[model samples]
Target: MASEELINARHAATAGLIACASAFVYLLARGYQARRTFYRLRQQGMPMPPWNFVLGHLLAVPPIMKTLPEDTQQPDAFEALCRANEKRDADSIIYLDMWPFADPMMVICSPVLAVQACQEHDLPKPPILHAFFNPLAGGANLFTMNGPEWKRSRALFNSGFSASHILEQTSHIVDEAEVYAKILRQHARKGEIFSLDDVTCWYMMDVIGAVTLDSRLHSQQQFNPLASALRRQIRWHVLDNEWNLLIRWNPARPFVQWYNSYQMNSYIAQELDKRYAEWTEDEAATSSRSIIHLALAGYMAQQKDKPRPRMLDAAFRDWATVQIRLFLFAGHDSTSSTICYCFYLLQSHPEAMAKLRAENDVVFGTDITETAKMMREQPHLLNRLPYTTAVIKESLRLFPPASAMRGGQPGIYLQDDKGNRYPTEGTNMWILHSAVQRNPKYWPSAMEFIPERWLAEPGDPLYPVKGGWRPFEHGPRNCLGQTLAMHDVKITLVLTAREFDIKHAYDEWDRLHPTSKVKSVNGERAYQMQSGGAHPADGYPCRISLRKH
Candidate 1:
């Protein structure tokens, strides 16, 4: 009986050894396959970064993440990488094997190539972004969908952004600008160092709420819950690298998605429910004049035509959430960033500020309300404000709100005007606007904040210089809210310039905290402004006094 037991034990040990050996062989095979794929891509003349056997370019990922101070550095790093690659005349393809994926990830820099990859429909949505945004948002929003779905959703949203609609929104934007002016006047009287970033973000939030939801919100007011929540959500989505890691790992993604849905989507739904209920109870009896009302009316009309669409109630609610969220996100951060940078540049170049104020004085005389009215009455005045437009344009070029990326799939090709074909298959390509905007090749004296570059004559060789522009990006995938953004910027500048002569309180640019998404001049997350809204922590501290002009 002892001998029979020993034989059984020996057999079990042998089986265990065999299973361990098989597992080792499988891992080794995968490693070899990944290496082989990397080399195959290189041989096909594809641009790629160096990779480790198992982790592709992940070792570099952490460094890239670390280089930026969560608020400004990520965007800056992306721009820096793009500039470095452009200098090398190398295609913008960074190899990333952070995942157990088939090929190295590619980042695209060239505008023509980015347009081809994004608009030609040759590339698939980046898997991480797709899974994170689409599933969480219910696959109905423009940012999440691809191919036919994206096309349809885009069609619906595009109708509301037609030229006429943009023009019509200008009056509303100017109204908000008056509010900003009043706030700045009050702050200036108190002589406080205020955070323009926070104030501007709130300003934008209120604007989006009014325009999209038809709800008036005092976003700039201290202790506003909705505004605070919106700010928190923005900070997380734009600045959090841990979230990025979770999304990269497939197994952990569902949990991350659930967390995001719980935090963002559900919260938004609750807010909407409360607002909708209030509207039904109090405002339904009166004529509604907000964009939300218009959208709801349009939606109802469409639903009446087709009674049995898929998840009609859920879709409408989700659609409203998307519209509001998109506007809130886009409006708040983009506008705030623009305002911060504009102030920075203006302060750095006092001559530019002087010129801007001079122009403001000529356009509006002495009254803030008159200035607002003139801005609306002569929209062309904005287009014609050579130096003001130049400064705004230059700032946007340096610190774009959105970074553009392209995904790789089979049969995808991007050919430049020079006939340089860059493979877009099975790779990711990103156009860092900061990099493109600041390239010395594209803009001579790239590091200098010179608004004059944009004031050159249309046909002049220096006009926009090659590869130097595109703050709003070029082609179909560019910012959909460009018009609205421009309007907001114009209104804010006009109002702020009218009330105060803004100057940098901090000596250097380093005073601001730079993050991946928003650029803050000061290390603090919020700035105390002497006038107007609180500046973002990543923005420079600028002092403003009543304008002597």
Candidate 2:
């Protein structure tokens, strides 16, 4: 009787526990369903692509999530997709499936919508999606900051990257360009197949190093660890692979990333401490050459009246580190890619090359050494290179280095050209730069390389379209270092073109891709480049020769 009674009590306790467990799970599922329903209701009026369970639209899947499609490999694939969607519903917001359980994102392709998002309504950046940018640019940096904080941080940087300040540093880029030309000449002598994209990146790194650190990083000659680390961090952040998975799951990848970050942060901190001490110790001895010096001066001037902020040392270090990283990464990569594309485009279109070279000769004169001397002594000559400027402009129009992203706030909306309003709440907005810049309505024969379009008279049909050409973007948050980028590109083009005549290594191109030629941007049966930038997938393999007199 006692054993039977004990068994009965044990069975009752078991039943009680199971009942509680089932009730808890039921409530949890009910809550999840309610949230999902709320999200679906929010997206009721929006035009979205078909979404899969747990994948949403799968558009924002990390690079590791699936095999890259051939169609999606094109640099302008996103723009192409956006164009297709616009045809279906011109006034509707184009939705992109991010991760499941997250808000769906919408892309803004129209200039009117882009301008409205940026100017009239201040849209914040999407949260968590831009985590990749956090390590390089901290939360406090201009890229990550919002509202009043961004304005304050941006103001300090303006002193260093202003038009006048950038022009003053023109000789610095000219000197860097000379060094780059020497390296290219060596490669030309060997008749080697080198990656033009890689070489251009190295040259731009050296240029940025000189401007920001006031030191020749010598990255072109020797590999710099910081530069390597920065590149690796970005590579890992974007391209997820076995190594990146280990980075998330295992300790080894994390260690490598941490070490690189530490090494870079330590170097920048030491440099900041040394420079600040020098400035405080001696004013006359402090040569204000680098952006670091200029920004520090601005900080000091601003802080003189206001009370010292807390943790000023750490804050300034972070500020300087972000700026250095920005210049090193964005400043270098964008301009270098632009330079590589300029060469690639010019090689394909010999007529454009001839026109550019003629302009260089007319403005810079035929003597290469004399031109170098003038570049060093007369920086103002850069302003007179109008056709060269136009060439760079047209190249940028074809290939914008980066696109703009804006997060929608409550009550903020986008309007179509036909005056249709699209509510933006709970949606992320991306300004598709490639689509906007290449609109056929604004630019006739948009895919063709035509530098003359920029030189057209005001009343002419080929005249510069108002608000149509935004290579560096537009509005308050446009690229801060645009002037600097343009200056570097112009200097590199002039000096390099003056010394070397570049030609595409068509044999090597065939060897790299033995198959049929794919249609490039302008429906031309040319080497189809599959990349996010203007460079080819295989990189621009080219032969170079000293220009015949």
Q: In candidate 2, what residue range of length 10 has the lowest lDDT sum?
A: 64-73
Instruction: State the C-alpha lDDT per candidate.
Output: 0.60, 0.69
TM-score of each: 0.76, 0.83
- Candidate 2 Cα lDDT to native: 0.69
lDDT of 1 at 389: 72
Candidate No. with top lDDT? 2
What are the per-model numbers of colliding residue pairs? 44, 1
lDDT of 1 by residue, 1-549 (tens): 999999999999999999999998997787677666666765665555555656655565555545444534344554444444332445443443444533345555555555566565545456555543443334445664568866755565664565566666677777776777777777788776665665667778777766766556666655555556556543333222334555445585455544655555665676556555554466553245344554455565666656534333676777777655555655566677788778877776788888887777676676765777776786656655666777788888766666666676676666656555665565556566656665555566766777777778877756775444666655566666777777678768877865677665543444453324533322323322211112234344556688764
Candidate 2 lDDT over residue span 142-257, tens digit each: 66567887787677667778777788887778777888999989987887677787788779888988888776777788878766776566544432112244444655656666
